[model samples]
Target: MLVPLTRQKFEQLIPRIATGDQYRYVWGKFSDFLRRLLASVVAVVVVLLLRWLLGEGFGGLLLPFGVVGGFYWLWGPVLWASLRNAQYRKYKYSGFFRGRILDVYISEELIGREETVNNKGELVYVDNLERRLNVEVGDETGFSIQVQVPLRRSHKGIARRQVAEMIVLSNRADLSNITKVTDIYIPSRDIWVSDYPFLQRDVFVEVSNRIRRDRLESEEESPRTPRRPPQRKEPPQLPRQDREW
Candidate 1:
């Protein structure tokens, strides 16, 4: 069974993650950080520009706008960090761990779902997102974990991002529930090749046949019948009679 990491562990782990881990673009962390930093800088620059352009007369109005903009810049990250921390706290706790982390994993979660109409209106069933872990573990029976990192949506507009996943493995060898930090791998550091490869696009187009295959098959299956052969006509009767005579 696979489970998400807990809040406390997430908080604890975030600080310990290698600086390299903070650079991963998969989760959009770095991009968000830069955005916030840029917003703050822009706010300051705006104030300076106003001061130079309008002098002391407009300072009163401009300062307030700059301050408000600065707050806006700070607000997003605070909300994100807080929500993530809350998610972790709910799962990791005193009774959860049967062991410690043996390995770490990371992969794209392939999303799939079915939509159906029911008495409760329309219901959506999301199958488990297909997950691919980056590493193998010896034992993963019972252990609590936490993951602290940037969310994927945060990087939608940015060119780069930092993403992460956390896993905690437990040792089930002894009946006595004792946990140890056997091994921990960082999920945030895996740099995704953000550059779109042209080959992949080409392969997709080649394999799918550009939607023409279905049209061609449909045409073949519904072929029109050939027109009946034109009726044969008697040779010119007058000419034939003249020859006979």
Candidate 2:
């Protein structure tokens, strides 16, 4: 029973997606390398078996090459999807933290170039855009943390200096692990406000108040003007004495 993935399913799955840092860890890198190596080995073995069975015929010579090429082309995306599904299952049982975003910026990186068949049945190269939302968020105790959320190039409405109530999840076994932002609430954005009606007005009020207090404290801590030294008074000169000498 195969169910078609719809937009609703994709939206539900977004929160469960793992952070990029998770994929960059040593073990993560090793796992990725292992997957590629295994895929390549399997592809080669399958191609050899086809050649042996078909014995150098037109199908054996041509089909084996096609099979190997297709396997290599689809391996990356298939591997990523498997990793994401595993991560989502783990995140479903994790605890969530509440925090407010203090700042945000977009970080762009080139993952790789992709090839797709055009309408004319010719392959074309396209750049794969990987944009991440690097956010600095603070908890109630003023302890701040940075987290990166993967974003599509077409995603809009997120800007620097926007405040967001973030719901973050972490790996319990590894407390120092990178946190995943499961959900976010931006009071300043009308679209978000309308989308999340359950968010109370007091939540926005509290966040706004905290932001103002932090700004005022930062301004007060700025360097102040130094006071000028008092001037010394000179003794009055003796009355001009006529040259009595």
Candidate 3:
């Protein structure tokens, strides 16, 4: 099914970004909250030092600005989400495909990050090779694609031959995206698996059904090639035997 993309439709289809497995960010609200508080404290400390060295007026002039700058941590995710949404909008064409899980690949790549203390004792972050689970899905059209999803506890639930459907977006018709994704929905499990939650579940279901219905109607209306009837066999041999008797 070809799903036309508009700004409103795009907005409706994709959900807001959240931290954790869906997005490669430090998990939990506390992490961001703590960082924001820490930033505010550091900003205050800098201001106090400025007050001691310079003057109260100089410190006071920048206090509010410094304090507000610290809260940049709060806008981090919001800005990130908005930027990503704009990038995703470039993929104007989207389609819904139904396929079965052909195979799953377990691999590692630098898609994760973690904080650690270096020799200097200052907190630092380094690249980590995270477990990436790629599911190979194909449909009757002989087209197949690999969808990379986060390796989580639910990974175990995704098994081979499971009927899975996904909403894939592209600038053109060809499939693209290795590091990013729109959304993948597994009906059997009633779960969504993707890098970003780009699909509204209820709307997806409604759209999927409409697409299927249209396909069925089109197939029904199409003219089918007439079939040749099977030739009938004669009972002459049995009739001859009965006449001779």
Candidate 4:
């Protein structure tokens, strides 16, 4: 099942973006404030010592402190939230897809390399393994797409034949080859699986109920027709996607 992205969905999505795990807040709460304060205190001591060693007074200290401190404390959260808001706006005009899981499994590959220094102080390259929670989903059209998520410990419970849904943000209008996808929603279980929490739980659940209700009403209004299961074909082989999560 699929629906074109609607204005209502976009409106609902905007408020939820800040609540997502991807949206980083520099000092969100009391604990956050304490943590930053502690770090800042240590940093201030270091800066003061350096200024004294360099024969610099308050004027020189203020410039470096203001520039570095303001960037780390103030600009970071604003920039991060702005980017997340922009991301939701882009996906707002995309396609929404509801489907059943055809297959679910894990696929691991060398996604990249990490640089680290060994005990001897020599830099060495370490292979960064990318493990994906690969879920193959299909709708009535028999067109299947493999939704790959960066596998996390929580996703070990995913199995075959679960009802799944996502917002498809693809380069192609057909949405056959999705370049970006929101987190998979399993409404029956009231669970979401994603490397990052992209949607607000309560709002998403509300949207899910509306979609399911609409689907049920549509089916009932139409005359009974023989339904065929989506063909059990191998998941399509697609190129590596550059996903943020």
Candidate 5:
């Protein structure tokens, strides 16, 4: 089913960006590590208890396998969440740029379920579809970046060559080495897409106004000759002899 990007949906879409609390950004990595460590300790205790009840022969055989599986289940998601949080934080500190959409396209990828050997040694087919919205944005400096919008079926109607703005991270002020695009705004469609849920409508409007103001300012600053008002022509002087009056 198609879903619009509401506040709730936005949070669900990017949990790492919506850390449980604001301060989590500062301590999130350590917090996640401690959580996984605590889970590992609990898992060890449970496994030991099971081994004591079941005896060494079977229990010992299960210990290695259990530890491996437990570690994966406990730490895998934590590691992934940490990485996502870090990425989001990086993007938050990046610089903002005004950009326009040069192109847009949809990419479709087919994913297949893992093959398993059934009792009859036959293969079962299970396929899934993954769709992505890719947009190319160009800044005034002539630098272009491609951003992948986390949109599903609802964005099928988006078109190419739309006006857009982006937040990007670059190594230098000249923006020669852009690393990523954190957000995008298409003013014409009133659509704002970002890596996080912080892209509000008010903020989008503010940014749009800023871009327009900057453009006006730049045009004003460029060298342009001011037009001089036409000088009024002096009426022809009355004939000097006309002073006969």
Candidate 6:
């Protein structure tokens, strides 16, 4: 069964996450790619117009300026639109609670034994490996689940770490982080937590439970259920009829 990760477990797994400027670099590249593609299309259009109207010489010089200005002019709106769209998508299809699962991946099982020291200088139990689960939620603004199992205990520190990393990355880099994701696949029960992360506990629980129930009911109503065949009585006079014939 899947189990949810605790906050403490999440913090322990923080070592694996990439932070600081690394996230910025990755997001920047993505943004730049989109901007460049849009700009290129605009530039091509401008050049085609310039060549047809002004022809050679000064047109070539003016073409560059036209393209450059067009580039800047288009940037703000495009950027706004991109961000807005990203935000919209994040929310529109948010897989919060019982929403759609964008993707799922299974990682290697963690096993073994280890010991660690906490702030109290006391020995803490640690495991070598546990099960890892990744679940993504939300539309444009989305959240994700990452849980790790300890070789010793079922502590899902790795999973929590992944979730926390996603949260931080989204907030820092202005990714679509519309909501907090808590109720995810719990390694403990191998089922989803009956709550959404960001919402009120009661509300999240209610919503999640309702969604789960509805899905179950729908499945029960599916036409794939086998129908019982009609029963037939045995033919009692077969032997006598055969003798008469």
lDDT of each: 0.39, 0.49, 0.63, 0.65, 0.55, 0.40
- For candidate 2, write residues 1-245 as lDDT tens digits: 00112223323434333333323332245666677667767777777777777777756466757566546633454445446545544542232233456777778867799999999999999988787767676654445667565664433676655655543334543223435543455656632311112122343345445544655786799999888887896653322111110
Worst 10 residues of 5 by lDDT: 236-245
TM-scores for every candidate against the unseen true structure: 0.25, 0.35, 0.60, 0.61, 0.50, 0.23
Q: Is candidate 4 or candidate 5 better by lDDT?
A: 4
In Å, residue 69's CA in model 5 sits off its true spot by 17
Which TM-score value belongs to model 6? 0.23
Worst 10 residues of 4 by lDDT: 236-245
Model 3 Cα lDDT, one tens digit per residue, 135-221: 987665455778886687777688888987776666654334322346677777876667655566677777667656766887899
Give candidate 6 regions above 4 Å deviation: 1-93, 97-197, 225-245
Rate residue 173 of model 6 by lDDT. 22
lDDT of 4 at 84: 66
- Best lDDT goes to which candidate? 4
Work out candidate 3's RMSD over C-alphas. 13.9
Q: After superposition, how far is residue 218 of candidate 3 from its true place, in Å?
A: 4.2
lDDT of 1 by residue, 1-245 (tens): 22223334333433322222222222356776788778878888888888889998888878888887777555654455444434433333211111223434345664676666777887766565653433322323333343222224322222211222222323332213434222222223322211111112222233224223643686789969989987986543211011100
Error of 6 at 240 (Å): 62
Name the lDDT value of residue 38 in candidate 4: 60
Clash pairs of candidate 5?
A: none
* Higher-scoring candidate on lDDT, 2 or 5: 5
Q: Select the stronger candidate by lDDT from 3 and 4.
A: 4
Q: Mind giving the per-residue lDDT tens digits that candidate 5 earns over 193-242? A: 55343333454466457546755787799999889998987654311111
Instruction: After the best TM-score superposition of candidate 5, give how far the Cα of residue 45 lies from its true spot, in angstroms.
Output: 6.7
| Candidates, ranked, lDDT | 4, 3, 5, 2, 6, 1
Candidate 2 to truth, TM:
0.35
Weakest ten-residue segment in model 6 by summed lDDT? 236-245
| Per-candidate RMSD, Å | 28.9, 21.7, 13.9, 8.4, 17.2, 20.8
The prediction achieving the highest TM-score against the true structure is 4
